[model samples]
Target chain A: MGRKLLLEHINVPGINTLEVYRKTGGYRAVEKAIKTMSTDEVVEEVKKSGLRGRGGAGFPTGMKWSFLAKPEGVARYLVCNADESEPGTFKDRYLMTNIPHALIEGMIVSSYALGANTSYIYVRGEMMPQIRILEKAIAEAKAAGFLGKNILGSGYDLELYVQPGGGAYICGEETALLESLEGKRGNPRIKPPFPAIAGLYGCPTVVNNVESIAAVVPIINDGGEEYAKIGIGRSTGTKLISASGNINKPGVYEIELGVSVEDFIYSEEYCGGIANGKRLKAVVAGGSSVPILPANLILNLVNGDKRLMSYESLSEGGFTTGTMLGSGGFVVLDEDQCIVRNTWNFSRFYHHESCGQCSPCREGTGWMEKVLHRLENGHGKMSDMDLLVDVSKKIEGNTICPLGDAAAWPVASAIRHFRDEFEWHVRNPTLAVKENFGLAHYADPLPELVS
Target chain B: MLKVEETQSVEFSTELVNKFAEIVSRYPEGKEKSALLPILHEVQAVNGWLSSVAMDKVAAYLNIAPIEVYEVASFYSMYFLRPQGKFVLEVCRTGPCCLVGAEKIIDYIGEKLGVKEGEVTADGLFSYRGVECLAACGFAPVLQIGPEYTFYENLTTNSVDQLISDLKDKASKS
Candidate 1:
């Protein structure tokens, strides 16, 4: 097994409770940072660790923190993005539901580093149980002198609260999250002021993903040098990959970065290969928003190099022949699955969650969904394929938020990689409605249950 | 719509008022309006859903305009504008779940409950709607009900039938 930083103690009984978590060496990071280390020291160590944001964007966490503007007497804030609504990405929910204290401990250290006295975790409202657990954990931390005034005999003080969103996927974007936190609609703001400069009611704020914040505890505990030695060159840490879709052992598994895609899929330790001995057709390696890769492209690159699950390796072809590791959602599709139907499902999601801020996104998403619906159900013409490409291109970079690109990329990628399937639907309109594009070279025939 | 709307004089229970105060205290001194989301949640829990009257009370409690509350409430998928069944079944219909059999499960819940999407059953016991990803893709075909969002994962037609029966039994006793 690789070094499991975040999930090392995940299966420990009562780990959710404060007393049990404390017994398991929790909150040591807070003591370490608050007692011996300076704010710059903590930030410097994280920078050395090369820890990128685990929340899709993969921005460097330390760089993001250093950008926090410290205007005289202006209070800065650290907001945790717990709105884990991205399809196929559930690692945050698992981390919070099972080990609530990890996030709390990390939040305290992260807050101290940024010189913020107040922080809020904006969790998706649907996750009420996890929110309750976090609230309990926060109360326990406050009672134990880790939070609230003068923590651990240090002169620093921080107050953290759990804020619930009204359940909009667009709120996962940092600015929209800030807007939602301020009790407004979840509309993403235009950037240049970037939350690090002016956020959360005109004060500087830093919003980090739930996994990224929790990963800081381990970074502080082991020291950044040691943490940097765990994963490959750039991907210098363990990542929690949420394995789902047609897999035997489908759940969150912590793997060292740069593990070969072949090993991650076929090895018994990770996904335990495809389910029911079926052949793999395609895999949305990251979350739904990333480009979907066919099974062949996933195992080997266009350059004939074996593919590794690293940022550099995954995006080698740059949205043309390769996909990014966007949140490590790892959704696998078997041969029997229909790409058109799956693309339609994602289009419907974008349409339902467009936020209606920009006309390109708001209107383009609905049109794409309608077109994809026609394409999926066999009521499409040849021009509909070109129409899909055109619409997705229009929505790609024309919006204030990445939600537009999110809606567009999957449709574009689906057509780019699987054009024959889309054509098959139009050619055999009646047959397409009655049947799926079955295992035609995409699926490898199996002799046994184990892939 | 409870008395929060008609009379403009009805007050929330003492316990709920205290709870709201405690939550509002988490924000900055004058920014208690940040507690609007949680307060709206409490309003929905106390009342079946957020009526105009309930929203007006929430607006008054937060000292913000009712339009602010309405804009926010309408933006989120969680808030219900009208009365729903005692139990709202929100099934995931996004990509990962659909790859596994979420669409079938959504249909199964609809047929068994005799309710179309967003419609409450005649007995006022069940309401079904399809939702975006619930972030539980590993266990596809997941549904959750509010107040706690209790998740029912790896669902099938048979399981949906059993869940409907279980909720019906609970509703009948209440």
Candidate 2:
């Protein structure tokens, strides 16, 4: 039943239309939430339901809604963080492309909860085609009177706009995104005023990710308590995971939050097992930003008791063995993959995407990237291994945003778990060279084409 | 915040306006701001780069705040805030592309055009900048001419020279 909660109405004929969505119990949440429940009651329902932010951080959704500066004379905004730029994550794209109305409907209901008048969907600029699709859906929603002044005889006035970010990865951070939305650079600002106090035109604003808002529709429609009953413990409700890398069937999977990591990988029910029948070597449980775990650590039960995927349980082992459930981008690594090489790939992405605002991140990312690049290219000294660790340590926790930490985590974790791989590469560079890096598509015609 | 200059006038030509109107008709009513990206895109397409005047006119047409229009235009890497040359070459200088001498291509172009990375040529014929993920990973090193994302696969010094020559030839004719 939880296999497709977010993507439930996806396959229905013409489900893209407001009429069809309404027929299938769409906007029922708004009807129930607006006409019946008070805004405080609605927020309480969400809080009691234990619904967490589905956009990686797993922050309590209702609690976040509670943070808004009450309906003051000043206007508040609901910003949907649709800038899904995490490596190995593409579920938000699917939501935007196939079932945009779900997101739009959710936006209306959620905006009502926080007493917001204007909402913006800050989508990544790279997703040009998906943005076009969402634009059409939003237009349809407005035409049906689901948006704008007076909605379904309710006097709630709301306006939705789609803003395309300049494709900076740092914009995924809420403060940075708000800055970018304000027609400036996408560099993140330190939080104190928080978006809830002063955001977007210096008014209280609520920024929730794409999946986080979409989940709110169902929570309100089916009673948040009932939604909470599905998943175990504090890891309530379902999670939309974007699984990729070495897996046989890599794509988006919506599952009850506490499903075991092993079940997700080995069970035919999820992911269809690893591709090429290769043995799993490691898994980056969350996005590349999280730590990477070796296969043995993931298979073993926590404290040798339970094998679980809940936020608390998964992170129990910390970066030493378990990875963060951040963003649910499960990128698995096959045995053929080299940990050093893969870690370098992640470091390289962060280095390129760094906003260059914070000194530590700006200087440290470059140093780490240069060290990793030299090591990966088979030109490494033993001291370079220590240097990589040293650079990552300096970069993490020293920046204005989580991006510096996100960039540093993979490098630090990879070295921690697979120092031998780096040592091997340093000891015998030629031996470490594989005939093929297993790139999907190689420029040389002799290599297999991806498309 | 930008006031449209009297000389530039911040108004669209008939051709760009027609394209903009056509795009607007594609969306539902009251969501005209959705066309903001495409409108700015069309302005950039016709006017080379988005001048402050052009952005203001676009803001007026979309009925969004001038700041909103400017935000979209500036946020995207593709949109040029300042003026660019007739041929703007954006070299992909991140990861896979950088692994195999995207820097060399930039160097070659700089030497050929006699301008630094962010500088437009004195003749206003060429400008260069570094970018990320042109989505041509297999190509290793790639560059785009204006908005035309051209991938130069398996690049060498000679191959880049050929591409420059080809671009120059095409620009001269067009």
Candidate 3:
């Protein structure tokens, strides 16, 4: 009920300081876990809470921690995946910037659960400011005996470090992140070894996202089961959705999981409705990686649809009538927005971001990008629309990582829901709108520096 | 092919050493490698791009393999393996920026500098590159120099010439 349940005392200016955070009960979770609760107890508490990973994967946090192979004298690690590279997803950035201590505290408790004496927060390099905040927070935690030797006199020593990524979207994948952590190329590795079994210098490691760790602090502070009771079956607790794009007020909203799709969009409480008094055309319920839902299906609750925002509900029909709440990156598009153009934009990002390690993803992403480019820029044929769909199919599951899926899903989904628009663009061979409203906005060019 | 530290002929000062140590202390025990990025960053702060000598000092201080450091250095677009010009011009070439003619601006700079996208000029005044989204969407056409971001709201031939002249002026003053 209190804001501190997630972002408590965060807004009190200067509260980021250790002295202020201490006054607001910041490291209380770490202290209580180390001093009182056993490592298994902490894990059990988290498991009972029904807390799931907020890092798009939706894996159970306790189950992930429980998976670490505890070999004798072998080093185990807890890696906080702060890479936050998902587009329209900046919740982790907001959390790390405003509440660094929350993550730091959570990491300490989670590390203790997994017998990890050392933890690393792998932040994206582009987040230069957040990196500074984490470094400062770690220093404060170390100074307060919340980290380093015998934390809180419990003899359960742990250390934390921050590693910035080298600007590759693929590195956001756990194994690739581990590879990057090892100072190697940031390319995804085959699963089954899955970070938990072999990761971070080939040691047993658990890589949780920033929001996932932040959620852990609350689970530890409140009994895990108590936290789990807040949301619906299987989808427990609150999720932080970074809502942007054609929304009246685009910011991060902490919604109780399983809230209805309609309520999330139209409710005065959530996004405050669409921007510019425009009609909602469609929704990319998750991050850009998920399929788009048509406005009719997304808003239709009468025909046994029950468009709720949960793992089970959104994915009930498997893209037939519903989508996912992935990473809670809800990007709402208004009627004025062009689905074809937006999909093309995402296609280019995936093509540029593909690590070139997998043949299908490497080539398919480029082909899709080119097709989308031709479609968006008015050089496309009707066959190009089908070609985009066909290319997405080729790349979906043929890659080492889900990045291929992340690239293919949006284009595939947009085409599925808005094929007419893609066809319209090809048939017209001109910009969709006579006014070129968004294009005029794009007329001005960035400055040229001889450098 | 040459290592970063091996290329730096100058010896680092005690002040720089202390700065590097402070960055190293940010991480906890047996996690010294976590400080690799920041350490390289600090080294670059001292000597423009990561020279072989600076990288060597970083690897030695953190007890990491030099190739480990090199892998990270080369992988990131921001980290330069070779020395750049006085000013590093990073233009955003992603969707929002690209939609607004980022490519034209990059081409303009390439032509003016008499070099390609990644090359520095003979005079060492400028080095230009096209980067991903800089998160300045309000200013669709955005370029960053050091920490300063300048948005081209209404770019034209005149504005392009002015930007180049401005860079020359700023380079001379520095």
Among all candidates shown, the one with the greatest lDDT? 1
Which candidate model has the greater lDDT, 1 or 3?
A: 1
A231-302: candidate 2 lDDT, tens digit per residue: 888888888877766666666778888888888987776788877877777777877788887776665543
- RMSD value for candidate 2: 8.5
Candidate 3 lDDT tens digits, A223-269: 88789888789998888878766666666778888788878887777
lDDT of 1 by residue, A204-315 (tens): 9999999999999999999999989988888889899999999998999999999999899999999999999998899999999999988878887776688898888989
lDDT of 2 by residue, B1-174 (tens): 123343576657787778778767633455566566656666776778887788888888777788887766765677888878877877766433443456677788789878888887776677888776443333346676654333455567787778767877977888
Assess candidate 3 and give its TM-score to the true structure.
Answer: 0.83
Residue ranges of candidate 3 with Cα displaced over 4 Å: A1-4, A301-306, A432-451, B1-36, B47-71, B81-130, B133-174
Each prediction's Cα lDDT score? 0.90, 0.75, 0.75
Q: Give the TM-score comparing model 1 with the true structure, all chains together.
A: 0.97
What's the alpha carbon RMSD for model 3?
A: 7.3
- Clashing residue pairs, backbone N/CA/C < 3 A, model 2: A56-A327, A166-B75, A248-A275
The candidates, ranked best first by DockQ, are 1, 3, 2
CAPRI-style class, candidate 2 = incorrect
Weakest 10 consecutive residues of candidate 3 chain A by summed lDDT: A442-451
